[model samples]
Target: MQQQEIKALLSDMSLEEKIGELFQLPSYFFNGDMVTGPAGELGITPDDLRVSGSCLSVVGAERIHEIQQKHIEKHPHHIPMLFMADIINGYRTIFPIPLAQGCTFDPGLAEKCASIAAREAAAAGLHVTFSPMADLVRDARWGRVMESTGEDTYLNGLMAAAMVRGYQGENNDFSKKGALAACLKHFAGYGAPDGGRDYNTVELSERTLAEDYLPAYKKAIDAGCALVMTSFNTLNRIPSTANRRLLREVLRGEMQFDGVVISDWCAVSELIPHGIAADEKEAAVLALNAGVDIDMASPVYLKNLKELAEQKRIDEKQIDESVLRILTLKNKLGLFENPYKDGSEADEKELLLCASHREAARDCAEKSFVLLKNEDSFLPLKKGKESVAFIGPFTDNQLLYGSWSFFGDEQDCVTVKAGVTQNYPDADVFFAQGCPTADPGTNVLGFQKTPPKEEFDLQEALDTAVELAKKADKVVLTLGEHRDYSGEGASRADITLPSCQLELFHKICEVNPNVCVVLFNGRPLDIREINQKAKAILEAWLPGTEGGNALAGILYGDASPSGRLSMSFPYCVGQVPVHYNHMSTGRPFAGDYRTTRYNSKYLDIPNEPLYPFGYGLTYTAFEYSDISLDSDILHKGDSICASVRVTNTGERPGTETVQMYLHDVSASVTRPVRELKGFCKVFLEPGESRVIAFPITEDMLRFYNITMDYVSEPGQFEVFIGSDSTTSRKAVFSLC
Candidate 1:
């Protein structure tokens, strides 16, 4: 269908039919049974289901085909229903979480993982995926940080654009097989909730919002993302779902996003609880007028939109515009020609968890594992000779896939015990459960099912682990928070390992001189105690399906860990929202002024993080020389290159992510000490030396000035190029 045809169809739709197209209901509403459960409680009637434009969280090709057949048979306009779900990281063949993928620092690899996820999801009859969350997160206490790419605007925008390309394909053609429309989510400042709580208020100035949070979403939209989902939080004092200034003036107007806009789960009706609307009718009017084209999982649009239009309280033209956008998306998906576009049961069977997909997952996990500590080069253990003891809750656990793996089966996951056995068949590998992943009676959200009952005695498990640690030559202590601990609605006040696990580790360390720690978690943890006690530590954050195999490869000399930290690991929970790119203060803390109490410094702890952003360790070491600039001045229409020589000084092959940072020494407003501008991941063999060059353009220096305009002023700037954010190899230049 073309533009004229879509417009003609919209003109023919009745007022009630157009209103129905704006409501998105769940899959159970179309089950053909009497509404008597959650749907009935929500006041969703049969008429609402009959004309709904889309369904949420629906799976299976056969079930989707059946639902589409039933819906088309009854829908007044015969518009096909769009099937959408939370296919964030993976569908069935799970991969590393978004944070871990960011550690890889390879946008190409992230794109591959998302492409595979899209293929698996498309085969299962999913038409849209609510993913590529472009939120910029700095607080580890926020559980949803696991879903973001990390703290840097450049890296977040880079990864988000790659994911958009991966999901929609290069041509943005959803009509092709294995391509699903992508929806960038949690619009505005969903990642910076107050106190790091979920759905809490977000307080940010327009400059900060534009300079930090909005760029990533704009990157995805510029890459042709088909839809944008309103966030649950309030930007400033207005809820994002009903903030016309945010949705209409900013997102659709300034961002130039002419795509369908959908509300987050039930966010339209949530305006009432948010103290912005009086009732359902007011909520519907507010959201539709604010530029929300679809109300997801909410009955306000179904129950009140028609009446609001009839009473002249809301414009009917808004209804027609929204219905047209929805129809345009359907036509873009080629659904008008074939409602069940390429959904096949055979394709699902052939694509899900295939060998190639497993290999890709393993490779990504290998690149994503960060070697945070490698004292005395204790890793790459003697596989066949050493008697190793694997002690802790995650030693043999199959729950390696983290939260939001909607369709992945834990039974199919490969455990660490199994991976080690496969890699070191002749070694004596002992195993013991140090303690449960968390204490009993832990509070889990109702949406996330309750954990299984702990059947073992805690003291006994600790004793068993200690004895095994004493007998074995080396101990591989595996530990982490439970999988449900870090996801949506799973925020925590303390971001550290459980007390029982800490006790178990202390006891084992007393008996064993050599210990290697493997962590499976979602967010950056407070690991001060673990850092002091362990000889080696590997941050394997929620590696999916082939997690064990990937860890084994790194431990047995098969691969080197090249992953870097996207978010900073704090010194303690009190240093909650720490990042590298913080604005410079008037009274800044300095080493020379440590004795002075008047400066901005913490009395008990350092202001810096335990591990700063872009910080990580690899098996091999790389040496960097001083940065050399091609020119000392940069003018408007030309660019200069900054070059640095990096050599693999250690006796092994490795990959190094050369990072380039810029500092605006004098600006209209306070600027960060250093900001990441460009990066390159280079692979090298031992004794190999390569010079990496980054082209510096004036456009890269632009930022929101004091007057709220994006521009760059002429000034002297400092540049640093090296391994991580703290590198001191610097060069000076001027923008004239």
Candidate 2:
């Protein structure tokens, strides 16, 4: 329905009916104590007060039907509640965590995961999934990093669009049998919280917000996401839920996002804490004017929206617009058509945990493993070579299934020990717990860092692992942050491997240098110390349900590790804001630091990252040569073509990702040293070579101008073609 028509209908309604449209009753109706529904003192009985609609929780088909029947009976409009849930990763067939999914560098996989998650959610009677968190997370110190795609704006935008398409489909209708409404959450600058802390203040320049933060949300909006959730943090000095410039000018006006804008949980109430609104009435007025369509889990809007409308404090048209959006989303879900549609109940809870879903999870688990280093082919441990010792707290534990895993069952998840036993039935496989993941922060200065209490002993586990490593022919040392280290509200001050585990690996390598280190981490880590001693380093980034099988497959050469680091692997945390796309400093550094030259360089470590974004190694080798550009100068809208010859020089067939980076040597505003423009992935057999070609145009070269319009600047551009971020062949070009 059009806003004008909804306004006409709402204008004819009484004050109580207008109030009813603004209120979203709690689903706590199922939790008993359902006297009134609104706040404590100003409550009204269910029979007395008229509720326009409600928000519900999904339990089962029969239960949903019961609630729908009861809810419709109370409302004269017969409006049904919108059922919502935090189905982030999956509803039934859980895949890898979002971070791991991002590592695959394949939007198809993310889309597929979203499709499955949507399917299961719709089947279970869920109308909306609060997901596809398009927040561009730069700091791995944020606990919600696991939920975000990664640090890059373009990559996050692509994945966000893909996931929104997967969830809501090309059409925004959720009435379809396999569709659920997509909610692009934490709407503006939620990722850049102070000190990478969740729900903290976000102080950033307007250009930074437009250039870095807002693009992903725009992508989600373009993909036709049904709803957008306001972030908890304040942007600049104003709360995002109440920021008119962010929600109105930017999101609705500039981006033309017509979908519903919902407040984050209790975020409307937080406007008081943000000191923007004096009370609930002012908060309601601020949020409504800011274009927040629905107030979630906050009673401020329910309490004051109608009174504001009646008193002309808020435009009656705005109230109707917000209500219409809420009702429209419900209508889109076919809730208004038939709120109790799924009446059929079956014995399918067992079928929810199917083998096909598990297999898909396994495929993703394997594909997401990144091989950081494989010196001298120490990997692909032959079927029956020598004794292999698997050591660490997570080597055989099923709890390593990362965070935000809704459907990954501990019983169903495959452990490394189980996988190894299954792969090499007759081979000698030794197991050790190693040290506790959380350890005492004992230092040489005799200062002790208190450790979180765990159920296991630290020294015994380490001693047992060391003893086993001494006897084994080869040792597979698995180490990383505990599963709880990177999920929601689990940010760490120091993003390094646990001190004890690092020490353990160093000691174990001293005893035996044949250590194959498998890192199971939620986010990037500083593992430079272990990288030096470990013969092979496999980054198994919190692989989900079939993780063990995937690990065994990669270790035994059943599959090649093709995943690249979506985020940079920092050598240390001091490089907190480090990225390849950093703006060029006034004086850029060159050559080694020992020359005593004053330039933009770090004193101790090289400016280079430990492992650049898109950097990954395989057991096999691929060579890049023969770079050519069609034209050095081209007119606007003219295409410039380039190609490079890639050859597989190893015995085994593998996939190689050719990355194309562009550098605008000079621009109005300082540009990044390098920016990823395009990429292509291809598979090759042993001794096979193929010519990879890419066509670049003005669109690929566009940047936000002083007027905030996206346009390409006339400049000398350097094009690079290579295997990863660091190594490439350069060719110069100019646009005329």
TM-score of 2: 0.93
Model 2, residue 94: distance off in Å is 1.6
Candidate 1: lDDT of 187?
Answer: 94
Instruction: Give the per-residue Cα lDDT of candidate 2 at 464.
Output: 86
Give the alpha carbon lDDT tens digit for every residue of 256-307 in model 2: 9877888877778888888888998999999989888877766677667767
Cand. 1 Cα-lDDT: 0.91
Pairs clashing within candidate 1: none
Please give, for residues 1-736, the per-residue lDDT of candidate 1 as tens digits. Answer: 9899999999998887887889998766756553887678888777777888999998989999998999999998898999999998889988989999999999999999999999999999999999899999999999999999999999999999999999988689978999999999889899999999999999998889999999999999999999999999998899999999999999889999998999999999999999999999999989999999999988899889888889999999999889999999999999999999868999999999999999999999999988899899898787777889999999989889888887899987888999989877887889998899888667577567666666898988999999999999999999998889889998998988999889988999999979999999999999999999999999999999999999988988798899999999999988888899999999998753356688887877888898888988888899998888999999987899999999999999999999999999999999999999999999999999999999999998999998988999999999999888998889999999
How many backbone collisions does model 2 have? 0
RMSD of each: 1.2, 3.8
Q: Which whole-number lDDT from 0 to 100 does residue 403 have in model 2?
A: 62
Which segments of model 1 are wrong by more than 4 Å? 30-34, 592-594
- The stretch of ten residues in a row with the least summed lDDT in candidate 1 is 26-35
Using all chains and alpha carbons, the TM-scores for the candidates as numbered come to 0.99, 0.93
